[model samples]
Target: MENLLYLFILLALGKISRRLSAFPENTPQILNLFVIYFSFPATVLLKTKNLNLGTDLAVLALTPWALMLMTVLGIRLIAWYRRWDRKTEGTVMLCTGLGNTSFLGFPAVAAFFGEDALSYAVIYDQLGTFLGLAIFGTLVVSVYGTSTRPSIKQIILNIIGFPPFLALTASLCLMKVTFPLPVIKLLEGVSATMIPLVMFSIGAQLRLRQPFSNVKPISLILFLKMMVFPLMVFFCLTMMKVHGPVLHISVFESAMPSMVMSGVLAQSGRLNAEVANAAIGYGLVLSFITLPFFDLLLKMFP
Candidate 1:
């Protein structure tokens, strides 16, 4: 209960910052850089280091990739049938395909499931969603993005150099070895900044109104992202007999709103910003309703 309030408060502050001259226009971007470079890696290390490497870890990690693949294929078919332009197709693909599995995910999961479950959330985010952002997210943006596209070589370099990816690598290497107490404490401090900063950054970027003309595409995108996709994942995993926190967290993370970074990418890539930003903004708001509904739904399988 308290955690959810924190989420809303931070988000409200970020949104309010948009109206204040004291908060610079680039505030969200600056905060994002800190999250990307420092807090994210630290959180990855701390959360994942002691992870049980338990049952269905593979399934948990693989889940987001599967979600992205399905999202791309599903949207492509819809886009083709609708004869949507390339930019609109790309915007929907980018926004709908990526889940806010990290930024909004960590705190929300903690609110619903307790902090212990966050390790699984970390696994889902870093190995699955975040990697998807770097590789799959970039690919969508490039191919469907602006005419100014990055080369294959440059893309590979980026995935290799991404900071959180490096942190995942380091954590994997150090998993078996115990860190010095001081080092763990240091990591914990830096990582603790993740939730507030992430929420603020997301709120700062939120835009409630796009043109009313945007209604249909935005509606379609939200349906897939927040509703259909997660339900699809839940049923499939249930059929495969996936249960426990693996079943719970995977479905929970999948149902998150559009990735905050996806909107940023849409704007940067010169896709349809109106659709992309609106989906992200509205999706976040709607998740307050959708997620609890999902939590109720998941209780049946668990």
Candidate 2:
């Protein structure tokens, strides 16, 4: 509990620093690009290089991805029924579909479940979250924001150009290669910085004003993100008879707040900024309540 409070305080400090400092508003994006391109890839390459890849771990890791896809489809159907325009639908899809699985989920898992759980979190983040972001996320933005579908070459480039995705691919390819101890240590040190930096960037990007007037739509999205998403994960895990840390971590990943990048995407794509901001803001604030309840529920499950 004390650790959780400390983490929250650290996040608050980051937010305050963003407002008070003279740093350019673009600093977060620049840093995120650096982390994504450099540090994250280094980490992925270092960690996954020797990971004992297996069918069970792969299945466990994919649990959240399947749940996310189902949730997105359900949200899209709801949006269609409501006759939402493309921009609104895009914003909702990004918000509810893309949880803060990397920045927020990893740290929380490490804090509660210990460093041993970090590997599972990484698998969930890299193979599940990052892949979805590169493919499904790009599809959502490109399809809803414009009249023309993005070219296949564009999609390929987007995935290949993504820093973390590239790193994951390289690491998996070089799994048999061995590095010197010194180099391994260096990679670990650099990789350790990714989570805190990503979290701080999230805090810095948050803006209260953007989500101000979209309470109703925001509430609907929040319900799906916080409640429906976790339920879907739980149902899947139960049906598969998954147990222990895999089950717990999958539930936790599903319960993560909306992705902060959703707002950044909305701003970049010129979509509905109000809904994007609301989803990010409300999701972050509400996760404190939802996370603990999910944790308890996981304990209750067989």
- Cα TM-score of candidate 1: 0.76
lDDT of 1: 0.81
**Residue-level error in angstroms, candidate 1, position 254:** 2.3
* Regions more than 4 Å wrong, model 1: 48-52, 55-57, 79-91, 102-127, 130-146, 213-217, 241-249, 261-277
Q: Per-residue CA lDDT of candidate 2, range 99-141, in tens?
A: 7887778888887678898888877876777666655666676
Over 1-302, each residue of candidate 1 has an lDDT whose tens digit, in order, gives: 45556767887898899999999998877787787788877877876666554554999889989988888899899999988888898889888878888768988999889999998998898778876776676677667765455688766666567676678778878889999999989999999987678668767876676666678789999999899989899999999999989999999999998886676567655688668766876786798899999999988876
Clashing pairs in 2: none
Which pairs clash (backbone N, Cα, C closer than 3 Å) in model 1? none
Lowest lDDT sum, 10 consecutive residues, model 1, at 47-56
TM-score of each: 0.76, 0.76
